[model samples]
Target: MVDVNSLAALLPDGVVVTDPDILGGYRQDRAQDPEAGTPAALVRPANTEQVATVVRWAHERGVAIVPRGAGTGLSGGATAQDGALLLSTERMRDISVDPVTRTAVAQPGLLNAEVKAAVAEHGLWYPPDPSSFEICSIGGNAATNAGGLCCVKYGVTTDYVLGMEVVLADGTVVRLGGPRLKDSAGLSLTKLFVGSEGTLGIITELTLRLLPAQPPQSTVVASFATLEAACDAILAITGRLRPSMLEFMDSVAINAVEDQLRMGLDREAAALLVARSDAPGEHAGLEVAEIAALCEKAGATEVFATDDPAEGEAFTVARRVAIPALERKGPLLLEDVGVPLPKLGELVTGIAGIARRREVLVSVIAHAGDGNTHPLIVYNPADADESARAQQAFGEIMDLAIALGGTITGEHGVGRLKKAWLPNQVGPDVMALTRLIKSALDPQGILNPGAVL
Candidate 1:
């Protein structure tokens, strides 16, 4: 075992804490892994040097180190291990925005929304907005390659990641990629680490690309009598122009939101779709009208169009709040499975079939335009049988996604909860390559062991 006292000595005072209560707090992330282990200590590193010191010490001692940011991970990505150290970047919260370069060099601890609001002050935008953006860290976003509602149009975290200062497993500090967007040199090492989920390295600072603030958006909210109609509207919307955002929620999700927000959502409707167009000037209104028409042509029960920004924002907020709102029903086993556009309807219907067959409640909310669905499986943990069925439904949903040529996880990292399905999705050859890289970079597997690979 490593000496916790010696580890504390390497960092500044108060950087390391071994308090039982504090350590208890670091035990589990949002996934609430029941088997989460008690960490021996928590190391709060404010800078790369301190992170390097911790990693070097851990590597030398063969101690497992779990890299955590904000501790807001939805998966078991940041769960502490027995006698392991939780190396948190919560104290590393510094951001420098360069409007001229259209980039922000941000410390890993900064929240996604904070980054978005920070860049917006300079009339720029950092596009990735996870539902937990208000709470989740930028580092966590990079670790998971998080996708959001707008990702259907703007792309995910990897797209805006221009560069990063990463602390490798053995404590070697290496800079990958940079401000210049057109760097084609060397193997795409930076891209590899973008979604490595802290198993391979600890990302300290990120150099992120930014775009101009989104233009005023027009909103379209459509209610469908059947799932097929809503899915067809989704396909039609995508077949034409690219909207800034397109979100979907099934009847259960609609009713859940309505129950919580009293937003006058249609309870009888089988599905609801919210589409937005951020085109400049009158174009946004025109595009929204087109989208509304598409929804109507696809047999929408009702189509509501609005040019009022506040009205549009209210609907967007309701969409973003779907996960939290749905939580009121029961605990959620959120699945982020994505399929090709054409296969999305099949995937959604297949999830419904699984829920019925397994006799579990699965409320689906999705970034429909991108074909990424967050199938929130609700179950009463108190009932052992129901919980087991819920767990079965969870795996079955991912299996269905894989069989349809889709992904098990579109944004959220494999973490510990989904690691079992990873090899099944990526195949042995890719898994071997992943292991090779993990071995080459983290020889002892000390950096977030038991995650990703």
Candidate 2:
């Protein structure tokens, strides 16, 4: 076992925690991987310098380090390894917004919602919003290149990341890019680290570009008698105009959400679509009306349009809460698979077939505008047979995505859980190039060992 006495002595008191109970809490992230291992110690650094100090110590001792933010990652990217030091950025909350430049420099520990609120104070907005914005850390968003309801319009975390401060594997701190909107100097190292999932380096701070406050949005909620009709509506809406948000929930997800929210959702509908338009001025209403018409033309069972923000948000909440609502049934093997918009219907149907073959209950919800679907496979862990079937269905879903020229992961990084399918998706050549880059940056392989590459 690597002794952490010298490491603890270098940092401020209480920054290094070694209690077994506390270490257990950091074993696994939201992925809840059954094989996650306990960490040696948990380190909560308050600033970049402290982080560097910890990394420097680990680098010299050849100790493995796992960087984590908020422990809300769904890909097991932050899952701790036995005898590895778990570095949590929860204590690094700090942010400064520059209204003049329309940017914000934020520490990795700040929650995504907090960044939005902070920037909103200056009449600016940070657009990348994962569904777990309320609980997920801004650093994690950047690390995973996370996307959400608005991503189909504004783009993902990498879009707004103008620059960042990262600690390389050797403990060298490098600042790439900046508040400048346009910088052509040097390689795009900043973009390289945005979704590297802590394998290359640990992000300390992010220079995020901001946008002006969003205009009031008009929302459209439609229920379909069949999943195919809902997919048609999604394709129609996207083909017509860009929406601020376009979400889909299958009947399993709809019923699950309705069970929790009691919002009078159509329990029998095969699928539900919630779309929004934030077009300036009265155009928002016009766009929503058009979307409603398209839904009706696509044979929606029922269509509802509302200009009320509260009513619209309620439906969006229903779509967002589908995972938790389904979790109430049993443990879930969550899959984030995405295909081209043209192939989304096939992907969704293919997933349904996998669930049927495995004899497991699968609830699917998605940012349909972007063709990214989250299929939640529910299983009774206590039942060995059921759990085995669920695992089989999980792999089958990824295999299906790859066969359809889709990705195994859309927003979530390919952590330990999804690394097996990565090679098949990217092919051996791209995989070799990835390894070359990983070795060049982290020759010792101490950073996020066993992830991605």
User: Each prediction's Cα lDDT score?
Assistant: 0.92, 0.93
TM-score of each: 0.98, 0.99
Candidate 1 lDDT over residue span 208-250, tens digit each: 9999888888899999999999999999999998999999999
Top candidate on lDDT is 2
The Cα error of candidate 2 at residue 210, in Å, is: 0.3
What RMSD, rounded to one decimal, does every model reach? 1.0, 0.7
Instruction: Give the Å shift of residue 326 in candidate 1.
Output: 1.4
Evaluated against the true structure, the overall lDDT of model 1 is 0.92
The TM-score that candidate 2 achieves is: 0.99
